[model samples]
Target: MRFPPPNPLTLGALALSMAFPLHAQSDPSTAATLAPVVVHARGADEAPKDLPYSVDVVDGITLQERRLLNVEQVLRATPGVNVNSSGGANVSTIYIRGVGALYPMSMDDSSVALNVDGSPLSTRQIAIGTLDTDQIEILKGPQGTLFGGMGEAGAINLTTRRPTREWEGYARAEVGQDRQFLTEAAVGGPLTDKLAGRFAIRSAGSDHWIENDRTGGPLSKPRDLAFRGSLLWDLTSRTSALVSAERHRLRHYGEQLVLMPYSKPASVDMDPGLFQDSRKTIERYTLQLDHRFDGSRLTATSAYTDTYNIAPVVYDGKLQSALGRGSREFWNVDEAKERVFTQDLRLSSLPQSDVFWAAGVSYSTSRRSYDTPRNTYGDASAKFRDFDTDRYGVYGEMTYPLTRRLKLTTGLRQSWDRKTYNARYHGGGMVQTDSRKLDDSFTTGRIGLSYALTQQATLYATYARGYNPGGFNDYAAQPDDSKPYKAAKTDSFEVGFKTDSADGQYGLNGAVYLNRVRNNHLLSYDSATYVVSALNADTESRGAELQAVWRPGDGLAFTAGVSFIDAQIKTAVHGIGDGDVQAGNRVPDVSRWNGTLGVTYRKPLPAFLGLSAPVLHARVDYQYVGKRAADPQNHFDLDSYHKLDARLGIANGRAEYYVWGSNLLDEQYDLYGYFAPPSVAYGAPARGRTLGVGVSYTF
Candidate 1:
């Protein structure tokens, strides 16, 4: 398939924002195992069977049924992916194939690139809910040829629900333990003969959920709100144009942490005098144009985003200092504003023959300014920094049939990056200013071969190179440490197979991969000064993954996925506090093994008791994460834990009512923890158990 198949129907009116608008309804596949899995990761719609690499996809119905509202929840069931969130979305870090560093996180480049629709976004900017989404895809391996620098491990793409021809809409309300509540609604439909429009809104919040020892009460509350709108115009029978806009605001309080040895679940002991709130706001806009030719399509996408964040905290976990009680608090006030713009143009062949090709060029620019107030030291100390970056790339990829049973794919890309950095510091017993500029270039490519073993099964192997953009340290104490750091790189190799049953009752797939890393990025925190500096080293990671889906009988489905990884620092003569870790240490915050098992069943009930026919729905999911090192030194380890989630519901054609539970066993485990100042340890206790009730109505 090409891109979205054009329809005769289009939007009829120019709807307002996310208010009540004329609605359009979209439907999901009723059968799980037989549903077609098509993706647009390559600038066109195609099945996973045609691609040589591994890409996992989850549709909207699956997300809604499981209540996977955020990236953290979505990754639990995805093989070879992990997340470490420390209190808020801005601090969340994601690791793929055990490559990304999980060191409390910063607004830096991620090993896995994050994208919305066809545009790029920073990993730091997307901690919000994934509401009104059509599907989410994770393309594993080094996606160097098409996605540009930054995706050293892989890439994530989130596709939102688009407007349909017919009038339809949906509304849902959910309430859970601890006063957790969420509401969502979306409407889409034709506004005119040639135009279609869509609008969506999502809101979620929770009262205090974590126990506090000092106040003898619960702490930490969270609030989030988001809105999105889209307009589509069928300029002609062969061309279409789309415009989209979004805005999000989030506010949160409390760290939800427990005093060290990782002993409790959702409990903390602290006496901080006052608590400050962390807030983030984002605005985004995009325009896309597509034109279809006889056997090819041309596309152009442009996007822009503006983001602001403010986070303040108490560093000492005490109220002993006079500065802690007054205007001059003993803490830090961090604030920043960032702006980004990107453009991409491509022409892809909608081949009638057995040959396919795509060529594209992309350009992006970013600028950010940040400040830290003097409260951190309770003195006349502060830091201000500015960063600017530009990136450009050109890429081409082609797949050609070599013989009846074999196909060859080749891709190449050339990328250039330029960065300017500036920093100034006052007080803290030091005053300094630093300014620098750096430019770098890379050549990345992939080559693969695929063989058809049978009509429903295929085997393939590929090799690729990936690049991660270099960055500067804004949280530095000395001028020397403020200079930009060198970029990290990776070489990856993978072999995989995909199979589907002839009757479409089952599908199975597996892949094995190995990666060689150069100058991998890591963070070293200074104990005495509480400063963070960049650390670089070589490393190796190898893993195997298996996934399967089976439909044994009508109205019953089973899904399973498992992964095993051995990721270690190679030349690990890197400094941590006062000591250097040797080679062969496991990567921090990455699991050695993980797996997911899930079952879903739906049956139609015979009409009885003065009732029409209704559908009964039930689903259960189990997740496991293996042991992981807490830090590079391997001084402490986090134990493995298991989680079970269940849902039971009744539904008609347009209405559904459900009850759900997560972590039903109340398992105890640590989400993430670290030693502050290299001595006092604090950990964010994982959530214990929560239950909720929900109702949804769709047209």
Candidate 2:
């Protein structure tokens, strides 16, 4: 199932067509037009077309309409993003542009950064639930300058709904397949003429897909809970303050399925006699204040977040047996906490030309701790542990306009980290105990230039540098004299074009980027002791992507998008060679060709139907992932495959129902690896087709 490469122009056009309204309605006052979207990251109320970064904004209405349950599901249609879910739906991870943290070992090294309000959380596990969000902004590229210490590949900023001057609130309920139940409640109103408050709570849970082979019993679905509350106060005519807090919990029990050599795949249900369970918990709080001065403006933000996760995962999926079939049982307990504070002050009175600038400082500190306990089914003890790491950083960014149509932006940041490890071994007469510490620092900078080709078109070129501080690994086979991980760096160069119509009916954005990476860290296991070791390698990636939005007419719009990536190992050493991956090698989890087309129509029905206004929507989507190496040998490959999904729904003003189907063609494909012994232990499997009907009501 191989296909030709996709054209950027075609992909961009298609994305815009589906996203934008193409024509006006027949009624004069009911005409459909493009709406303006503003992003505060740039510190201005400008349209998405004016932002130089690759940004995707998913509105609240769209999320509700789609009945999106979690962050992973909401981001499914987004380009350059891949989500891997463990069988039976307990564990999930997101890879953005093939540039997310593969291993969640430390807090200092994250490829994709996430910020809720102003707080930087420890792990993606904290961002699992679906909430009442005002907007979700996905900003692409190296965000080292503005965010600092994190976001080497980019960042996702989630802004939750806020209280308003007017009283408003909504409560929603939903029921779905697998005995799934969902409930959400929200309230917002003015506490006083100068004060406001808002609160929201959501709870969802269901049954898992795994069925016990022996007892023919179903497992419990992971319990999901989320709660948020906020308050705003107007101190003076020109000053305001806000405080918000949120909490989430996810609890589940069970393990994934694995394949064994010379045997069929099997799911090793947990030993009920041992009484073992897994759980992940998260808590976060945020506070911010804004003040407008006569000559200068000052803004301050502060937040704290804590996360705890414990999973007794085994290296091999096979269960431990009396004969020792290379199977082992172990539990990993990871705990992390982060505290951040930020402030920005700017002077905006230009005496000469229409020019102004802003300068700010950011500071953040984090601590992480991990412990591993080994259990041979029933009689195993603790093996290794790492106490924690203390990390902090500072950063700033500024923008200036040389002319009305020409502007420039520059940013810089510096970060430092310290780590400590603790060990306890109980295999043989190996009494190994030691503690190591390392202090490292790195700087990242960005420079960009923009030009307005026309009122509706703009072109920009940018050069950005990204870096992350390395730290200690809990499991390294080589216990004696193992070097601490070192810092890694990447530099990117890019140029792009952006266009938007005067009426906002159509919009297009495209970029081509080349990134050079040094000291890239990779994991390898030692054959003798089966100890995992970290290796440093050099690599480079080059690619291009185009995304667009289109609005053809009232109740009619479409969107399409595409991307092409070519990544390879430039240099290799230590049992890792450069030849295994040649030029034009497609990066794993990234597709070479993908696109989606959709349309929606809403109109007034005839009086005979006894209905007021009825709206109908249908969409067709197709995505193709190219074949690539599924193993280190580079010989074994997973064939490329395509999937098509469609949906039809009817909605009125307050309540809506829809029948949705995914993988309509029932095409069988693998989204990730299919490991078979000696090479890798676990391989991700793609799910089959599913049909479901859902309805939602707001009161």
Candidate number of the best TM-score:
1
Query: What tens digits encode model 2's per-residue C-alpha lDDT throughout 427-476?
Result: 46455676777887778868888888898898888888877567766454
Per-structure clash totals for the candidates: 17, 22
Instruction: Specify the highest-lDDT model's number.
Output: 1
Quality of model 1 by C-alpha lDDT = 0.76
Error of 1 at 222 (Å): 0.4
lDDT of 1 at 139: 88
lDDT against the true structure, per candidate, is 0.76, 0.58
Alpha-carbon TM-score of each model against the true structure: 0.91, 0.84
Worst 10 residues of 1 by lDDT: 7-16
